[model samples]
Target: MSHGWSIARRLFLAHALFILVLAAFVGTASFVDARDRGYSETADRMLAVATAIADNPLVLEASRGADPSGSLQPYALRVAADADLDFITIMDTDRTRWTHPTTSEIGKEYIGAVGPALAGEPLTEVSTGTLGPSVRAVVPVTDEQGAVRALVAVGVTTSNVTIALNARLPAVLGLALALLAAGSIATWLLGRYLRRVTLGWGPEQLAQLFVYLDSVLHSVREGLVLVDPRGELVLYNDQAARLLGIPPRSPAGAAAGGAPLLADLDLPASLGELLQSGRPARDEIHPTGSRVLVVSQQPALASAAGRGKPAAMGSVATIRDHTDLQSLGNELQGMRTLSDALRAQTHEHSNRLHVLVSLMELGRIPEALEFATRDLELSQQLTDELVTSVDEPVIGALLMGKAAQAHELGIALTVEASGSLSDSGLLVQDLVTVLGNLMDNALDAAVSGEAPRTVDLRVSSTADALVIEVADSGPGVAAEAEEDVFRPGFSTKDPGAYGRGLGLALVRQTVARLGGSLVIGRHQGAVFTVTIPTHRSPEPTPAADQAQAPRA
Candidate 1:
């Protein structure tokens, strides 16, 4: 009740009750006063009338004669009645009524007699009157020579004074009741509304509701994330929601989404791999989406907090479309097959041409000589295109391999390599996969181009790194497709010449595992440089190998 009521209603009711009480007091006071004043005035008028009758010698003489004069007796009776007199009497000095309006009743002794009036002193006093003890006023009547003769007492009833309050107090009471009722009702209503509005909520419930909502937002597959390197989610978005596969509602025993789903995509292993290499991954293709997602990751890092090693507290990976890489890989693979077939045809043709020339020198000269000039010119043109375009031997070795299985194909390969590789911390199979794809890509690009065919393969090493660069002589990739090139299945070359985007991207993947960087560039032609950073490896001592060789 205290909680619900308004301050205004409380104040109003308090003031109202006070006002009612004050009004009651004033009303009672006013009524009592009016009645008293009315009664007193009537009493004074009656006393005066009685005194006048006593003072008139004719009336006094008549009354003393036992009703002798009719005029004086009638005049006194009329004056006393009109003045609302309850009683009238005359008293002598010895405290006895000398004459009374009720003559038979007034001859007894009087207790409230005005004695001075019967002596030489004239007087007035309010006292009990003759008519059954009413409020009264007394006056002394004087003789013509200013001598006190007798006293007259007049009075009216006191009952009429209290009756005045009867007519007005009920209205005042009704108004007070109405005001109090209105105040009580208003206070009660406001309080009830407040109670009703706040009844259902509690502190614990509000906290739990917010927690549940937060869980819904952060439990998504597509990296529903927000966090500094500490892994807090500040504004994990809706795409993350879809990726994480969070359900709309999370009730008990609800489906996975509702229960707050957590998908583990080998994040621990992936993060370990990332930390080992202090480089961001770009054009990274992962099978995280319905279609493969090619992601370029950027880690906006904050300074170390709380410890000597500031951990990678802030990191988010963004995703783009990666579906086209597969197609590119397939196309490159097909071109590799075509290049192989051409290599086989070229070998067969060269062998036949040599056989014809040998037969002509053995005297089958007419037919052989006719085809010899054309064959020689064809070989010369192939050599000219092969040597002029590129400048690396690893690239040339790839071309030589392609040319073995391809015909009418000009190849150009280049290399700028220094320093030697000892024991590398990788599987031969993995290295083969990486280098094989790169060279295969070179073959496809070289065969697909016009006669000015070329491929550049560069592999190098610093004190702690192994870097490989491969380039081709095809028309350079479009500027817009540069970033798109590494996405799985994204291909800019003729589909006939290359596979889907498995080659360069796979190379990049293997490089990443080794904690290395791969750079792609356009030299005289397009080039790719794969850098592998290594730790200090023990070198083979010359003396030990020489000592071992002594047995041989």
Candidate 2:
């Protein structure tokens, strides 16, 4: 088994190692340069001293004498001692030494390169001679006519160069050590900063977190979009792209100057406005293409520990596909209405039965028979009227069921029909959604009002469109709020009601989906008018009838 270091430790270690290597390289170069400079300075001083000796008139005159060494020996020795030179040799142009540091080496041929000197050139170099390795310079001694008279050589031994280099080593090493320490400190500080930025998570932990967050964002059904405070898109999940009907990835040039703009996504105008507003919004239903999305938005906020105000960072929005849910809810509501109608019918039948029994007990057999016969005839008449007037079974059953409910609620419900409907393109579900919500709203409004409450429903069909108008005897919608009534979650009824406002919105959506138009009439009470286009077909089948039948 092997254990790995944390990210902070690994980063610190790598930085420290790099600094160490760099410091070593710099230190090595500095040391080599210092040694070379020391040697060069020593060689230049030797060359200058040798040139001065060669330029002396007395030395030049003596070098041309019968015994040059006899005159040059003392002068060379004194100069060598005073100038701290390891060796100084004066020689004739034949490369024969006239003076040397050791007397035994005098009069011997020079054991180093003297070719440049013989050609009357002055030069400096490090070379091995009778005195081990030394930095030496050779200068050609010239007479008054500039003719070469002799060669003068001076040098500092390798041992002296070593001493000089050693003198500067401590300071160079100290500087290198200081740099290493500073680098270590910097590396440690950088590591600490990175740790804080990462919230103390290592690379493995961060990777895991990223994978988990990505999975959750993609797996969830709701669409999620995050935008910066400047109305630029920051992050969005796959669901968002799917919901908006956009490509899975941002398009080329979608981001302006490396920051994505929300407007580039081509969202619905209402949704774009909401996202740009950066305000908290809840349950704002907006239509996009053929889908209806319920969007909720919240601002991302952050605050310092001692700060009095929170800073607005950005906004996050969740989009839910509510089209299917709303349709199913509309169907469920229709079933509930049918159930209420059946209950009312049952109550009415029980009341009639009690009346018949009471009449029989009173010993008025003829009156009892007449009463029973009259009640049965009236019920049959209403059924006949509904069956004869409305040809569409779904609409007919819905109206009959709503009439029964209204009767129980003490609201007079009236249904008037003028034409028949074909089942070709007329969806029963859509009709139920439209008519059920309208009648339910009308009944609720009329029954809650003063006496003589009434709801009038008029149905008429043309060769191209079906018209429905529902009017209720209640306080009409306020002028200012009429336009807002169709907006989701907008209701003038009880504020605590959760689902009261969605009915009218759903009705409007269904009408629009069928390429129909809904208008609110400026009448004594609230009047809603809807017109839906239709297509003709053959008579309804048994299956169609059964599908359209009310649950009761």
Q: Candidate 2, clashing residue pairs?
A: none
Candidate that scores best on TM-score: 2
How many residue pairs in model 2 have overlapping backbones?
Answer: 0
**Per-residue lDDT over 143-232 for candidate 2, one digit per residue giving the tens place of the 0 to 100 score:** 778889899999989999999999999888987888899999999999887765565566887778777867777788899887888888
lDDT of 1 at 47: 56
TM-score of each: 0.34, 0.81
Least well predicted 10-residue stretch by lDDT in candidate 1: 255-264
lDDT of 1 by residue, 344-391 (tens): 767778798788968877998777876777877986675555444334
The candidate that achieves the highest lDDT relative to the unseen native structure:
2
Score candidate 1 by lDDT: 0.55
Off by over 4 Å in 1: 1-350, 353-400, 403-408, 414-422, 446-451, 493-499, 540-552
